[model samples]
Target: MIAGDPAATGRPGLLGSVWPFWVLFSAIYLMLRWPFVATGRFIDPDDELRLVQMRDLLAGQSWFDLHQYRIDPPGGVVMHWSRLVDAPLAAVQLLLRPLLGPALAEQIATVIVPLGTFAVILFLLSRLAARLVDRDLAGYCAVIAGVSFPLASQVLPTRIDHHGWQIAAALAALLGLVDRAPRRGGALAGLSIAVGMAISLELLPIAALFGAVLLLQALRGAEGRERIGAFLLAVWAGSVTAFALTRGTDLTNYCDAVSPVYLAAMTIVCAAGSSTAVFPRLTMPAYLLILAASGGLALAAIAAINPQCLAGPFSSLDPLLGTLWYDRVAEGRPLFTMNGVLVTQWLVPPLMGLGAALVLWRRASGADRALWLDYALVLAGTVLLGVVVTRSMALAAAFAAVPVAWLVRDAAQNLPKRRGIGQWAMSLAVPVLAIMPALPAQFALTGVEALSAAPAKATAGAQPRAGNAPLQAQDLAAIGNLPRATIFATFDIGPTLLRTTHHSVVATGHHRGAVPMRDVMVAFIADPAAARHIVVRHKARYVILAPDLPEISNYREFAPRGLAVRLADGEIPDWLVPVPSATTARVKTFAVRY
Candidate 1:
């Protein structure tokens, strides 16, 4: 029922409805092309690590101790993440590699992740919109809003990561809730929650928040008893099923292993009594609050008891007791680190406020209001908790469009009741207005304009082969040749480097244990001896340093005093006492050395 036949509905022809999808798709496609088009970009955060992990998987690596050929001060092999994120992409690439070869396999896999992810998100969002709004309009809006949103521009066309998959699962969870059949909804919700938890534990709080809202909403309806019972049963079944699927082969054995938090959630749901007793009080705000609190407590308790459950078995250290916890707390001390409050948190709630007002102003029934509020709260909570920076915030920000659309619908309804032209213009305007704020940041990050201007920079640094190799041009070309080379690169270039090439990088994006490696990277930047030692130890063939990368601005500042100083002097530092030049093999952009 969720994915109906597009043609059979007597809706407009594919050509008629296709433009919205096309517009959104083209925008996303262009956004994806921007970094590749510009200075030959790379993702500095987690992309490199993921690529190495995939590489290892393709090379027949084990699932348990996912390893990377790290090139940081720590150098050589190190354990990074579990198989959950990398394995899926690796498997797809592996399948394609035999037929299409490794390069093509990688290309295919990266493309599929985003395309597949968008398809799944679109399908689920479409289902939810259909149930809440009209079926036809819902389908149109899901495609329209989903494609045009800046969030799509941000996530897709980068390397494949768990975050995009998480968004898809989140959409699925919402779809499950909105589905007409409670049983099916429950199962889907359970699965969605489990899969989403596996991808990013940051979403756990949001999941909990959502589950609580549903329970409270169920309690208030006329058939509240049955609704509440169904929802509780679904939550219990879903969690237990998830635990069973992940923990081991045996399903029955998971009972004894069920964490105390799970037990508490079950206990709370049971205490809520049958739908008969709970349903009559559904309209009271106090009842809703209590239900939501209880459900949230259940999730938090589980999280507290077994922190690993949220983000899967392989995870960064627990944020509370782990070293990273203290580091993050110290780093984010300006805000309440203990509470996990992030500063850029204000953006989401205000958007949600606008969405909420629009929802109310639309004169949507109580059920619609409740549903919107529930989704809004969970998403807002996730942002306030500082789970991630832009992507998650964008996910939450995207909901603002839904409410805005309804407001547009009301406006269109009131206008001279125009036929074709006015309605189309109004619909186009709503999404554009909703997504305007993210435009500048999106363009800047993607470097659409900067790409056009790169010719001048290339010309400025023409052929200054001071230190055996031209620093600027080769650095530009090195990223494109990365997949075939083992390179020592700054962390800022790590992600995009991984996405573009096959090279193994040292350290990327801060994880709990990466501080030591980062310190070593710092030493490499500050002291040439340390830098040489890092390069020599890793057997790295190439060294990549990007001055424009903002995250490694500290490293960037040291570039002039460190690497650039050596480049200017034409003297290899004593640490690299016997530095070798590219003697035998030289490519147009980069020199190949062993």
Candidate 2:
């Protein structure tokens, strides 16, 4: 019998061992990611920008100077990212620099750090699963997590973005929630949430859910009160430390990024938790009343101080930005609207996992039942988030692996002992089903043909043509060799320009660079005369266009008679002198004549 089986006796089965499976998974991940590492193809704009940040750090930029001066010139755009992610990356690069030199050391460090994060995530998932089910089942869950497409993609080579770290923080919080030891668990969960918030506000929904769970627990009794109090203290401490260490003297910016406002809010919440812990003997009704009062006062104080934040960080976003840029971001779209393959890959495992979790919850009792309920809540919340935004699918899939592993293990164990072909096929089917959804959709579609046919319909960026290769470093190197000047380029190619060349960019995909992004959008979509005026006013020396980029479609649709449209149609204006490059140049560059 499998280790988790209720009827099993004696020693655990094959899947019970954790380290063997972890080693195997790590090997597989490295093998799969090695190709991308060799190519140095940083998949997303965020990853490329991370390398730029690291380079800046190594080049003697101040630790608190998060500004990319190359992007907006004299007064650079202040990045919304925290320096927490940079520490380890820069450390690894520094450690290896003596042996591998600068370039090679950076490449190896970039590959290793993300994969190392993947390993940590797997261990956390295993530990979380072990609490919910048996050790064997936990191992299976680790395997499922290892294979999860969305989760794995985020930590793949050169994907040094903060998304993977956010997911790790989320899982760490989950582990804390399920721990039997109240104080330690509460502290862990609180610290994880605080770290996640410090990284990015993307985890705000999950963080809220965690906060709600703690509140509910506290309402139950004194033990809950203790846990909640511990949680609050940890959050307060972690947030303050993270802020002080990362933001340094620039602590007043309370807009998009985490700032003094968040610190104040956390302090208020911590005070409430401390008060509850102090009066643990209070009646249920009185406790509830105190909680309500504390929450009301906190919200009131926050609103009074930063009324603009009540509208959310993106409240100040221009309508044109909402319509043109954010609306086009694939991850922000709902699950149903995403590509069929992604929908299949993302939705299936979670749905099955949820089903498995429900089954287990129904059978459980006492402490087990409570644990299962907590796990179920997390899974359910993530699934709901996935439905709302496609990006949350990764988190959903990671959590889903817990229960789905149980389902796979249980099914495999129940198979007949006979060595017939049917039995073998049935045994194999359990894991296969757990890994992928019904294969009818996956098998029916042709490889690149189907993806290409529905390029615009696909999530994220437009799909490249079947035979076409992506733009490489060499392609951007030529443009980088030109005179040091701000290059006006699409958001997708901006980071590449920054990485491959010494030139600065007008705008990237980051929302914090909204003003420059808006200017770029307006110039691209406006008439030639207006475009020239904006370009000259910004002192943009060169304009670079990657005509085949997915964002180009937005430019064409939004402004039919705009400069970008005319340029794409081979009507280069006299004022914009075309800079000659190799015939094979994937990007076209033009000198912006005043």
Candidate 3:
């Protein structure tokens, strides 16, 4: 039997113990996340544009011509061959759209894919935590914490981005590494990092932090040499794979920019560090020397790349403080909501560690303490790196969850054993209590929705009756069947467009690339002249406006100069431009020139 395999015990079956975990996880996640996913709740002003890029990729747009709908703002978010998650979503939708049809495929990809991935990762985290705590009770707690943590709730459903896969990848790597199965652990870690890099570069620092912690553990004890060696080798292999996968036409450009010099330096540092595990007597000296030399080199490299790395926190302190305090507010979102409770997530790891510390305080073996400490350090380093740029909080949270699970598992194991009614009640109460913190927020948002009946009615009154169908499956099917078109649409509409239609959008909520598209989107919302110019420049065939939604501001001045089609339940408006199909210039004036 594979070590730590629950099946080895000849237990009833995986499902007997697993079903309750899933039920609890699903209940909490659905309650908090369902509305966002169902309503296609995309609020970040850039959602529709990124969907355009995804749509084009599904339509067989060339990798070289990755930029679709050319009027995209300069340096706009582009999904450059980052096939880690996008490939599967696009391929599944494409295959199913042709067979089962666009509507079904879209629904499946949006609802099923995100939820299914979350389930798998939560299961693994629970199992891994069970191993650390050596009991089933702790496993249950870890699973609950994994699924119910506020940070996990926010990111798992509402933000249907590639970060989900990255989290799963990191969890898998930790499972392998924590178990001390070097080759397997190393391989998983490497592959996870590579996949993370492909999905989003934001994960690199977190991966590095994880690697450093593992390396430190390997340097400290007798078994350190082999473990460290395995980790370093795994990291190198993963990097090579990631580079191979992502570097196509950009190979030369990336090669020129990514120094072989730095690569070699890293390899040397890794080799020396890995070597210390073999020579225990020489471990401390070798480690200190290696640390000093490597630290010096890293400092030099940082100076070379961006002297800002060495700049005492004060140098870039203003941006950090502004970001922590006011920048999110400046963007017209609550500081708590802008990035989905990023600051709050930081507190989770420590809480988890405290729980673990309580359980392990006197009971844990020396080796286990070392393991936990290593992970704690790694988590801390990851947070620091992630905080440097708030966009990385999702990845940071991914790292944080592991320790939290470990600690929660340990705490649960320490709980006094009970029987019968007490046991059953306790079992039910644990998950409920774990998820209670999330209830207030979910209830508040839903409560706000309830209290806003006046605005809802006002919106209903103002909208065209025909657009009120809530973007049905049939409308999506019809749009998907049409020739690929550039569209003007709201952010909420972008993912559905990517999932169902053959059209490219001007934006999506992915803020990374929305920097360029923001100005155009604002113009579309607040200025009619600019909107007209943008429509002409992109050769947009259709402009979709949701009248009942406050997003009506986004399409306000876009006076339709062409065929306007009011589809059924006309709460939405679809305006068609009658200009020649290929016209690339603005219609400065529609009045007759004669």
lDDT of each residue in 418-475, candidate 1, tens digit only? 4698676775555444435345445565685567665545675566433322123344
Q: Tens digits of per-residue lDDT for model 3 on 1-594?
A: 012343322333433455566566656666776665675544332333334455566778765444544334333344433654556566667778977886567545665556666666656566554545433543454464455443464334434566567677766766656655555566566666656655655455666677676667656665655565666666666655655555444442221122233344456555655555566676466667875686577557556655653553224433422332224332223324443233443434434544443445345556566655655565566555545554444444555554455444433554556557767566544334343433545566678778875653565346344332345555565556556666655544555666555566666544423433454354344334445565656455566544443334223323222111121123222223322332212111011111
TM-score for all models, in order of appearance: 0.64, 0.91, 0.64
**lDDT tens string, model 2, 1-594?**
211333321335423455676677767766886776787776678888988998998999999999998888878888888788888899999999999899899888887888778877877776666566655565777778878888988887688988889989999988888777789889999899889889887888898788777777776668777887888888889888888889899966466767877677777778877677787678888877876777777777678778777788888888999999997788888998976877887888898888888888789886667667677777888899989988888989888887888888777777766388987887787678668764656677665576669546677765654222346766776786788898887787888888878888888888888999899999999989888988888898888877767777788888888887787677888889988862134677888887
Highest lDDT: give the candidate number: 2
Candidate 2 lands at a TM-score of 0.91
Clashes of 3: 25
C-alpha positional error of residue 51 in candidate 2 after TM-score superposition, expressed in Å: 0.9
Could you tell which candidate, 2 or 3, scores higher by TM-score?
2
Better of 2 and 3 by lDDT: 2
Cα distance off (Å), candidate 2, residue 413? 0.8
Of 1 and 2, which scores higher on lDDT?
2
Ranking by TM-score: 2, 1, 3
lDDT values for all models: 0.51, 0.79, 0.50
True-structure lDDT of candidate 2:
0.79
